[model samples]
Target: YSSGPPPLLALRLFCGAGDSENLLLGGARARVSRRPKAMASAHPSQGLPSGMDPSMVDEYASQSKLLQEFVKIPSIGKAWVFTSKDENASRAMVSVSQSDLLANKKRSFLLNTHISKSSSKSVSFQWSPFPVEMSGVSAVVPSPSGKKLLLVRNAEDDDSPTKLEIWGPCQLENEIHVARSVHGSLYADGWFEGISWNQEETLIAYVAEEPPQPKPEFNDSGYKKEGSSQKDFRSWKGQGDIEDSWGETYSNKRIPALFVANISSGEVRALKGIPRSLSAGQVIWAPSSSYSLVFVAWSDDNGFQETPRKLGIKYCYNRPCALYAAADPFKEEADKPSTDSNKGDTAALVKLTADLSSAFFPRFSPDGKYLVFISAKSAVDSGAHNATNSMHKIDWPTDGKLEGSLSVSDVVPTVMSPQDGCFPGMYCSGLLRFPWLSDGRTMILSSAWGSKEVILSINVAR
Candidate 1:
């Protein structure tokens, strides 16, 4: 049991003009206040309506207490199922969260479960005795081998720095604190979040906020000299440029950029060659020896007008985006100072889907033979905010060579209308990181079927 102050139970009472009462229970007092006539008329009764039965208030309180108990039950947030070396056994890690109403925060924890399959085609799960609480953690990612765990704790304020902790089986292995000058908090939101570990697990590539832009500096003399680091109480910085954001939930958030961190040396570097007009997200390590990166880039010119305008992109799948590939920044730096004349072109970003208007959520096959992605071309071509989705795959070069253009093949075409009791269409929100089954050609994903959601096993080879 946790050792701290006992949980606080609060009860608020609002009375009419001439009604008042005092309640004391469990060494705590209830707050009671009177409402004015105008407010009483506008907001109605705080306990019961004018004509409603007073006994109903007691019933409501009883139901509210039941809801509080229900709220205490944690909800599953994420789950990962791993196959064990033993043929019939497996392990699963599930992240669960509960709302702390007293503290106005969310308490998250991880639970471990062991699964075993029997010859009778039955399955059973054995849960651990206690859960491990993850306090103040923004994200937790495990390496491919499950030997290393990465925990991300984002800064809560401007003065604080983001912290990354790497934990081994027994103890904490490494802790890295990133200053604000390097980059802002990493994007934990699933939309722009893309944290991936390479095959070797020595490096990690993810999406985060770009470094803050330079602001206009001024002093008592008016307009401080350029590149001057003079420090004085009179000198202040002004907002240099007012840039438009993706709108809605993205307010005050910086443009999402690509970054890579060397877990061994604790060095982080932003990926180069991406254009300023595009924002990157959902990055993944390409199946190449050089460790190339593939990501989705959204253009800023997504407005209805001719000029560039930043539109709300949270759930609007119609936003024009395309998948692009770029060489690893570290590899580029290592190969610099070479006499190759085509270095510029080789280091530049290459568009993987030049023909499709919308492509995202790129996933490589288990064998790295094909790169499959979801397309919202119907939504982009039409003016709809969302529409039926289609699945497509590109034959990745076996030699890890990227060309100017690659042929795209459609696995699942968008179905506008369906017959009675037939397959409607694919309305997918997102895909699991590893959606493939034992067979390398089949993929399992969830899609919307009318008002209900159902899982489908699609064979990309078809």
Candidate 2:
């Protein structure tokens, strides 16, 4: 439930930067003057008056009166927005999937919109002439600089190879073909999908099914040892040992691994030393530093035993996971000792969130002042598949030194249930890998306000 101090209180009662007025919503323009006393006199509850239409106001009045009176942004499906750290340009890449029952076919289209910063306090969006057809795309990711986009086409058949395409704004830059033996199909499901582009935009980090294990060979006479490579029709192969994956969502397959690919050279490197008992996913490139990879590793409950058993991870936030920072396999050698290891080990994996039970969706601020993340501790503790979440931030050291005892400041606390006419609670399906506005302190995210998913803007600085 949206809780505490009202979700949109900051916008309705507080004033943002600048003295000039601008249109905050579509088809409506509310003048926000510097004169606060006069503005407050009009609405006792809201210091800022609504600039939206009455129909929109009535639609949202029950959920949040203050939000209805302030701003109205349409609900979006799958979307990606990127803004340069210099704050010079911003763009949004949005997609919507549609299926036709009569035709029995499904398709998706991508719309590109340019976010214009009219002023410090004003913003607007202008859509392109037409949307580009994304016919066979399994996943779409934009680079940090917004100069390049990565599109993945997963293999529909077991014999076909997976395809990766790198595209610029107007042209296809490069393509890479990955065989099934190198790595199985890439995970596009939200929970297991882990794709990221490095700061320099030279490499990409992602998660995919690990290489298949070698099977035994057979001969016409009987079971053949490793030395025989003759085809036999009489002998049948035995079943191999089964590997366990997370219960609900990952039952069909197992073994999610971390990999890095050099876009320019077309070379892929598999990260080693990560124990087989722990499945890795949701990886991202850290800020400019020696330890460039940060990912979430989920350990099996029976890690000590030979047959490692995985705990349920799908939609269940209760499973314990910590953010791990490690050296990039491609940039650094495997034998090199990790310089930032607090745990006495030659392996490059360094645990960052040792104190938290569950942590995911890591985002470094534009200025790299802090690392912000979301925690589902309540869901884990209560044994619920999904529950309210809390937002937290760790003050990043300017000198690029990080310790285990870094103090974590709470940005948004968990709210179970709220009173009537208030925010229900935070329903963050998942935070965008990079969910930040032009200002470092302000962030825009989507969450379930009641039955409808709504967008929320929160200022961690405040």
Candidate 3:
């Protein structure tokens, strides 16, 4: 393995998947399809797994169609590309969804490698010798240490429970099962996915649907409360009043809540005091010394309007959100005096971004000197679901003394539209939590720089 500092790396771009079965790869065109049907499913998860089928690899090896097909899927749906914080391994994991609606199930392929190549003309991927197929995976995230991977299998059957599996390089290390009473389906979509691992690697924070509210049980006599006995066949139940979850994408779902899981003991603790009026997502661990959690909270706050309305947040950044930090629940319990029967309330939750109208992805520098994030204020102000973005940074307090006084500074100003040939403005849906290089100053972010989503290297130190 190369012992030098990792170079400024970039991603390989591919032509969009099309109706034809032939794929143009590295200047060589390969007709790998047998039918007139579309080469691959539009969604990445539904697309063929990375790497040509081993049987076909021998015959089509001449074409070297490594990532030509792998990179072409239209919607990567919660894709994750991450590298380890420690230098022990110089590789990274790229997880792509292959969700199949017909099967009503989701799966993913894990390709491990270091993306150190950038080409101006062609797409390339030094894919791991082969991809590991993870079946029925709802979400996947890599730990900061890169030594562990978290794979989530959401309950597909209403009665089934959610399963969280922690895997090391060789085999499964631990597993945790969360009951439906504790939470419902996880928020795996890009906008609501908040899964994160703390610096210590022992705890994981994520966003999931809160436990559903109980429906009213009706008997032959009348409607009954919780204390009432079970209904018999003679008693038919009436439909309960429907609860709307902020409209649009969240139909029949409850509000999203923040939860922390202890990997070793398989315990989950919900952070208390998050108002039901607000929804939380895109959570990341703060510098362990400063705070336990940092997440974006969207509130139902309206100013001067006749009726208060909840903005549709799915794929929409225009909904106003600000970063907030809170202490880990377990830590708070430990700090309390053991003898004190009355435990104090959860640590005070602090709002870190009072000035930013839309700030989400939170990435702390490798050295922990700065907290960098991307803003979609332009989209928020323009009322568009998607638009150009801005990058900003905050000088983190050395003593971990955080307050609302933290000021946001621009690193990359908003670019509405890009001029010819130059890089198009930022269009990142979200960023990898530890998207930093070894230098601690430069970060690698993927944005819709142009017709294609391009990887960019930004030097915040400048």
Candidate 4:
């Protein structure tokens, strides 16, 4: 192993199936052990290099302590974040490391990485002050082996002064505009609500919306909210006078599409199928990398509009959400044995239409052959669990392990609830890492509840 300052590190392992409570693995099945931190002693007197001064040694020691304060790192593959409901500027970071990178492997959720979203200040790593902004780490995802870090930040758009900025291994200091999406209007633009990084973190998936550019003639393209148009702005009496005023006509497309970008080649493209104009919120990136699957759920009308008329309560019958899977031609690292080998082929396509009434949480199994989603809207399952919600599995085409439904009477609430302090107010907004642990058959699911909130994970082995 190359010895030097750590380029990056993680604190969590992938997911799988099992169960847990105050216990981590399977409620009672999981066990815990403690190991000690490493020691670097060559005898204090023998330490200093020939030319270094004794005073310099003391100075260096003090600096090291300061760096540890801000450069704290978690284990690889098993970290998550949780946040609030309404968009806010507060959040907490939680992580679980498996102990030694190589050794007894004391795996556990040992530390909490909490930070204020608005902490945009100067920081130093060793001898440099790495300037940082606390705008918010919209999403966090661990690479398959937990070797790389993929983080998305909120940035200023090309047109406006605010948008999403993505940073990580591919380009450490530079930020790229991988996706564009709209919210309600100019002022109501949507941030990232859903994100899923392929197990390897080579691919990035997120949900964003871009307000529709209205038609010039009868388009009402730059339609103003209520009477707050250019003509009415003159009459308005206060600030936020333009918060959500710029809206496209109702009939205009407002759905956000699935955006996938190859972090390396600087390639950015919107997923196929979605109307670039419609508003698509909450896009989830599936774990499998061969095929890109993102789910976009939308409303027939303005989803945020609370008014019954705006909600079309009388006319609207139900919610419309669909799953779109785009297969890329990239081959698995294993498939490419030699550098001279040709690139891989495109992934086979499969589209799933999930039942809407239940608000199912669809999760793909570690093998990527099947999908597991909640079947019931809600239930009371005794012993702390209110009910047994339905759990479903779709067979992986090759193994055909898919099952119609699985009973959940035995599943515990703590396993499904907030593992590392993701209370109600702080719901999971996105996943920092997918299931990890077993060689490949099992992994952890890291989910976020809200803003830069706290994300937690539960261990599951299928």
Candidate 5:
């Protein structure tokens, strides 16, 4: 409205309670009417700018009405499907959001539904009567057993502490407030974000911004001595050193680091042993009794010639990263020191995908026999922003003993150029946390296929 062109009108049809396939097919036969000339003659009372096209005003009004209708329909966000004790019954929790233009924010809520299948292969979804709004919530994650829910309410201001609420089936169980001195906001942004609950559900590991670095304290008397915390009204802090962050959307963001929270004791500990030159994210508890953490680490030397330059990582799959495994900090502290000369190699951080240039979204198979992950080696090697992804698997030791070097097998190789009607390789932006099917060997994933994105059932054993 401020002298710019009208917003592009995007019309989307949503089939709420009907056969969506037939409705979509019927759309092909539907027709749209053209703009009538009479619409150009607008009401005189509605004052408009000189030389402005009257038809544009009418068109804008019409489009605005359609937008209002569309805005009423909330868009689906994250969803989780859980199987119940009864084999025929299953439940699903779907998060949806609608834009509240008046408030200049989004209103989020959860839709509960019951899914059932008949003998005739017919499926039905019984949705709840109303959705429960989740106000002031940044992220919601359900535990593996679906018995507990983790709600993250990131701090809105520097003074406010970030709140982590552990909600049980019937009530709020535990709430922990993390101060800025421990860490900044948790990374809710999809790229570097990784929130994972341990198998026991007693601990959670996630990625968060490191605590604020110390600044140089100064006063009217010039630079103050370091470590002097004397209260002086005239004393001010100076920018100590400027650090390079992942470019683009990561402006003014602190370096990402790993942290684990004990749900029972409400104790949060920042993980150590990772090199300062690397940034960690997408953390998950490894399939081990000790609960070792597996995560993706991006080295600071991501630029050409191995220089310490951080390129824009958002949507840039070419960034160099690799999977790493490190022992749990609490477990390491509790265990006695080993006298074995090889103990250092066993306890230290181990690179899981040292042979690959890029690896992420690590997931362990249901049987805990293999660790599968998607690789962007094609994008990394060719220096492309993105390319066809390849799936790889590592044979995990049954004894939970990680070796220095593990064998990696290629499950799906990159397809350079596919033929007509053939698969155009896997173009997956992200992988689900639990992608395995009932067979444990079959994995369900969504990948881009030409103009459409299609769900694929891949047999990892093949």
Candidate 6:
């Protein structure tokens, strides 16, 4: 809860810019006070969207005092907030600019009300009721440092597509006002089709679909027909029709190219030389170390040739979105690593892939010694460990082609309901590496059930 000075605060609203497709300035004022209750009616019936009458929103003060004035901008969206602390009260409202976000404009404002008696607490939804507009920001992600907000916005024009923008450390908590961006100055090109943020918030990856192309006849590398085991690969259907090779007939659904960027330096570049599909699983940064990895899975004709009669899903790729890793070397390492073949290249942790059933949510142990992953095995055996563990190391091909050197540790059976891989034990997500652990080999993992993760020892050094 927070309280602010003055018994009055009001702001001005203005008309929308001509560039805005929807040119109407939407404004609002929010307040906290006491008033008589009115007979309630359903919102649509009351001719009020939420059955909330702005009039009944008690104006503890006779008039809405002018507080924060926002003017002639594309009226984005708006929201309201009311707060109470030490029996004192106040209100807040905010509106975001669509033109601002679409154009990569960095405009935002935050207000702080030092509620009396109390100061710190989880900032809940009830604290403020101001409507803020940012719908054009199809996706938003906060930087690992909490100092910047990344926004992916679609082009305002009908024909143009989406782009990427960054809102710097302008938004400060505790009511610090947000700084706005300059119109038309915001942009990172290419149609930003998808996005996923790493846990550290330092690296970012997105998929950009290229223009469509014609498909050619292929009877060579990937497809073969067998009487007993031949099955459809494109669609998971046991027997499905295959379409002809036409550019427009088939959509421009090419495998999405992935790119990683360093938030600290504004450096962005694409990860090349990896076999990936647009619908692949996510790319992530190693939690304990600073490296980017994208994982994808593909099978040879021998692997996916057979399919059961009964089917309920699509393409039969048992494991998709396999994790792949890449970490650009730092300056010092680039300048001074062994060029010898025998000593081995420890400087650049060559990308390593793990061979198992299927894995997701792969994370490195705090000490960067072991990787913990939830790998998928088969359903028939219903066993505790990966049925097939093929570990190997390969010389990374210079052509950007990945050579498998995937490795895996023995699986630890579930503490409860061993049939299921997931355990009912008080140990799960929000896992943290606490400094207080007696042995560095052990780290703490959190269980959302009831308690935070406590130190637990593990035999990692072995």
Superposition TM-score, candidate 3 onto the true structure: 0.71
Q: lDDT of each model, Cα atoms only?
A: 0.85, 0.74, 0.73, 0.39, 0.85, 0.38
Off by over 4 Å in 1: 1-54, 289-291, 305-307, 338-346
> Local error of candidate 6 at 27, Å?
67
- 3 or 6, greater by lDDT: 3
Residue-by-residue lDDT tens digits, candidate 5, 40-116? 36644247775344556776787788888878889998999988987788999999999987797899999999999
**Model 4 C-alpha lDDT per residue in residues 1-462, reported as the tens digit of each score:** 223222211111222322421224435444333222233343343566753444466667777766555344545533344334533322333434433433544433423333333346543222113223222354445444434555555445445422334454355633555333333212122322455566555666665445334422212344345533355332423232112211333333234445555666655544544443233444554543444464544333333322222232112222233343444323333455687344333233344444422223456656665554433223212211122233334443453322343222211132345446434321222232334344543434333343343434443334
Model 2 poorest ten-residue lDDT run: 1-10
RMSD of each: 9.0, 19.3, 14.4, 23.2, 10.9, 19.3
Q: Each model's TM-score?
A: 0.86, 0.72, 0.71, 0.41, 0.86, 0.40
Candidate 3 residue-wise lDDT, 1-462, digit = tens = 222221211111243355434555577877553343464354333433463233443445534454345434523434445544543324656666664545755556777666553445443456679777877788788786678989999998779888999999799999999999999888987787889888889999999999866777767678667766764776665556644466687876678999999999999888877887678988887784547788888877621121256755667677777788888877877776888645535356788888877888888887778888888888777767777889898888888878648887999998766788876678887576567777889888787754687788999988
Shift of residue 148 alpha carbon in model 1, Å:
1.3
lDDT string, candidate 6, 1-462, tens digits:
123222222111132223322222255434333222353453323563342334534442332221122233445333333344434444444444422334556554432233333356434324334534455555555544435567666446434544556666464222111111111111222121335556656556655443233333223344344332533444232233332211232232333445555555655554544442222334444443334454433221112222222221122223322445654323223344476532223433343544444444444444444555443334212432223221112222334433455445543433434334433333332222121144654434434332343433344435
Per-residue C-alpha lDDT of model 1 across residues 1-462, encoded as one tens digit per residue: 212222221222332333554456677776555565567756533566554444455666777788789889999998888787998999888999998878988899999999999999899999999999999899988887777889999889988988889888899988888898988898988888999998888888989888888898998899987788778898888999888999888897899999888888888888876776898999999987343899999999975432388889989998888999888877777787777755644467889999998999999998998999999989988858899999999999988888557899999999988888999989999988889999988999999998899999999977
TM-score of 5: 0.86
Of the pair 2 and 5, which is ahead by lDDT? 5
Look at candidate 1 and give me any clashing residue pairs: none
Q: Would you give me the overall lDDT of model 2? A: 0.74
- Number of clashing pairs per prediction, in order: 0, 6, 4, 80, 0, 41
Error of 4 at 289 (Å): 7.6
